[model samples]
Target: MPHRKLQPGRLVLASHNAGKLREVAALVAPHGMQVVSAGELGLPEPAETENSFLGNAGIKALAAARAAGLPALADDSGFSVAALGGDPGVRTADWAELPGGGRDYTMAMAKVAALAEPHANRRAWFTCALVLAWPDGHTEGFEGKVHGTWVHPPRGERGFGYDPMFVPEGHSQTFGEMDPAEKHRISHRARAFALLAAACLPGAG
Candidate 1:
């Protein structure tokens, strides 16, 4: 469906991360609206009490939209390990429950490695659930996931939060070893963002 004509003013991204702000900024900049994060406006970061990724995403988006008095987009995502019984799903961002905590990809990988009985059963995927809620009470949601297998001990210094251990479907290298553009093109977050852009961006990229 076509976007319900983007509202006429500033739109906020219901997030506190610089990375997320940057991504959402890029996604909505072309739509003629300024996209800023809750942090940028000195707004309080809301706690995510929702059980599921989509639930949490909607909660944030709706809260921010109400707070900013503008349409808002929020996303919640995680790396779920099959062998680990889908652990780290809702807690992906909450890893250590601190700022920059999710950047500890090594720690994340170690935990997953501990769970995998054998080397081959360590399969997993990154899932992203995004919600776009407008000030007018309108909303849109999309979820995307990229399948991959863990890289045992993890590798590389690039990316974060399990990137070093995640080898996308067919690629021989991990997300940490790949360039930003390459990862963005195939990442779960990227796919999720792409869906939002295509469905709600109008002319956004």
Candidate 2:
């Protein structure tokens, strides 16, 4: 399919996560696109019934685009561990959902550590699936992954989610420790965003 040129307009970011919104907003900043969060618009978070990242991302993007009557961008991201057979993959976000309420990454990291304790292969990766959808139902998708290992006692406090426990293949610091600018440059989201820019904004990256 030919690349879809995204015209300048208000694009809804189909997410309530502050960190994701910030990173994605920066990635698309050069394209002159105005990014707004679903939360800002008071749009409801759609049920992510899909099993795959791309499918879930499309669900959110489509829901937001239709509700806001504007083009929308959404992403589904998670961590996969080789030892755990990529566990906490699609379940990454809810892995630490408290029994009563709330999500906790600290517990999530602890679970990962416990599961990976006996395994010699600590190889893992972060996966992100990006989707863009228009009000009319047109959509585009991109995927990106970054391989690395899991660390114990979770390090740093800069990034969110599994960042503190993930050490990218070539980096000394976990994603949680690295500067946001540096993380964005080599992040799974950044890789997907590059593809999105090439498709929708031509030469914008």
For this target, which candidate reaches the highest lDDT against the unseen true structure? 2
> What does candidate 1 score on TM?
0.87
RMSD of each: 2.8, 1.1
* CA displacement after TM-score superposition, residue 103 of candidate 2 (Å): 0.8
Backbone clashes (count) for model 1: 0
Q: What lDDT tens digits, residue by residue, belong to model 1 across residues 1-205? A: 6565455458888888766666557656767777777887777878889889999999898888888888888988888888777888898755535374435555656766876756557688999898999766788888999998877677777776677888999998898898877888888888898877777765653
lDDT of 1 at 82: 88
Model 1 segments more than 4 A misplaced: 1-3, 7-9, 98-103, 117-119
Model 2: per-residue Cα lDDT over 73-169, one tens digit each:
9999999999999999999999989999889999999999998889999899999999999999999999999999999999999999999999999
Model 1 has an lDDT value of 0.79
TM-score of each: 0.87, 0.97
Clash pairs, model 2 backbone = none
Instruction: Tell me the TM-score of model 2.
Output: 0.97
lDDT of each: 0.79, 0.92
